[model samples]
Target: MEDFEQPVLSVRKINKQYGGGCASCRGPEARGLLKNYCPVCGTVYACRNISFEVYAGEILGVVGESGSGKSTMMECLYFDQEVSSGEAYIHSYKNGKANVFAESSQQKRYLRNHFLGKVYQNPLLSLKMNFSSIGNIAEKLIAAGNRNVKVMESRGKELLEHVNIPLYRMKEAPKNFSGGMQQRVQIAKALSNNPPLLLLDEVTTGLDLSVQASVLDLIKTIQRELKISMVIVSHDLGVIRMLADRTIVMLDGRIIEHGLTDQILEDPQHGYTQKLVQSLL
Candidate 1:
């Protein structure tokens, strides 16, 4: 399969379930009752049997309503949350390949340090409040083991320009910048190391239409110019249409539809997908 040609990232049969209440605290007769009261949402399965592949240079968009496990799945891919079962395979240009679930702690650390870049739904939270935009971008380089101050500064400026942030404002703190600019800075930070895969979690979610369009264009331009693959998670179909070659529509922790952007948009087969298309239209 084309998808098996050393995909940048692959998620296989992922089943993430939250644990239920403490049965140890309950009496023998009440043990059954404890099952109904999950300590975390009563032992719900946030994601079930989720499988997908993202090849290098492909932009795959995952769309769904709020509380549909979009963010949870992204978190898992980033290694921010441990998977309860199944696996995520990350193939790196330098590190060869490693299963996210099976890697030792040191191996996982190496993968995170060298290969992954993530942008969250809120740029403000992702960025450091104490650092300037340049500092923020430079920090990633430092974390990646680049120690030369001159090299870090040069790369930081190049990244800022690449993301369309002005050179003059590079010294300004992210908190002082507008929402759109802050998002651009976050993108710059994510691109600092030029990782093979980028996970964008609704980077344009709260922006105005005009700002949103600009951010989307920036992202598209960066993807092409950098030749990097991405997995964008959003609830907005319009956003997916603008950036994704392939779209995956998810609902209630399951993928309701997956296909070419036009196929999914113009001729949706599933009821949930149809509703999404209607909303977009």
Candidate 2:
């Protein structure tokens, strides 16, 4: 495991709420004798006091059930959603540092353009329907302001090959590829900008065991080769064990336990973590 004097990303006391009473304030129930049905308890809390750190070059896995806020917290950290409270800080080598919550629009744009990359579970959502794999990756690099189009093309080809997608397939739409291949294309797209921190949300979910293992191996190889920090959100303990240096187990939007992956897998301190491990066995 690697240690960092400063973490690449730090999240503290985050919170997110949705569908509050305001949205339902004027519903039919609020109009008459059924007023009690519009009780102000309509708000749903998606995240609360979530805190964690990702050290440079270390892979941190977050595991939890469906409604446990794993994806919400990841999205908040990545600035996909505005945090209701607390702070998310990203350490930047280029322009000092800035909190994801406190940064100005320009600063946030700088961070998104230069420092971060994300991979979603569905590759089709990430790709352009009208563009080929090479074109899609090249377009992102160009949009990020890389000057040389030929260099972008070359790099795109190299990345596709790096992810084990055939060079010939580079000209085909992502829809033409298998789920696993599409995922590989997504990985290539996320790496197109050479981001220092990568966030992966259920990257291997819904794939066969063999394909999942292969994708895991590819992710591990990329992490090792690039030495970039990674945060992976998944429910699969096997996937966490295969890729994570450390694991954090969450439930009901709170971290129940955290430690070295091997330690947690072998002897979990929290009942929830133990149950999860047992179910895997």
Q: How accurate is candidate 1 locally (lDDT)?
A: 0.81
TM-score of candidate 1 on Cα atoms, chains taken together: 0.89
- Residue-level lDDT of model 1, residues 179-220, one tens digit each, is 899989988898888788889999888899999999999999
Number of backbone-clashing residue pairs for each candidate, in the order shown: 2, 0
Candidate 2 stretches with Cα past 4 Å from truth are 1-3, 19-40, 93-96
Candidate 1: residue 78 Cα off by (Å): 0.6
lDDT (tens digit, per residue) of candidate 2 on 102-132: 8776767667667788888877657886689
Evaluated with lDDT, which candidate comes out highest? Answer: 2
RMSD of each: 4.7, 5.5
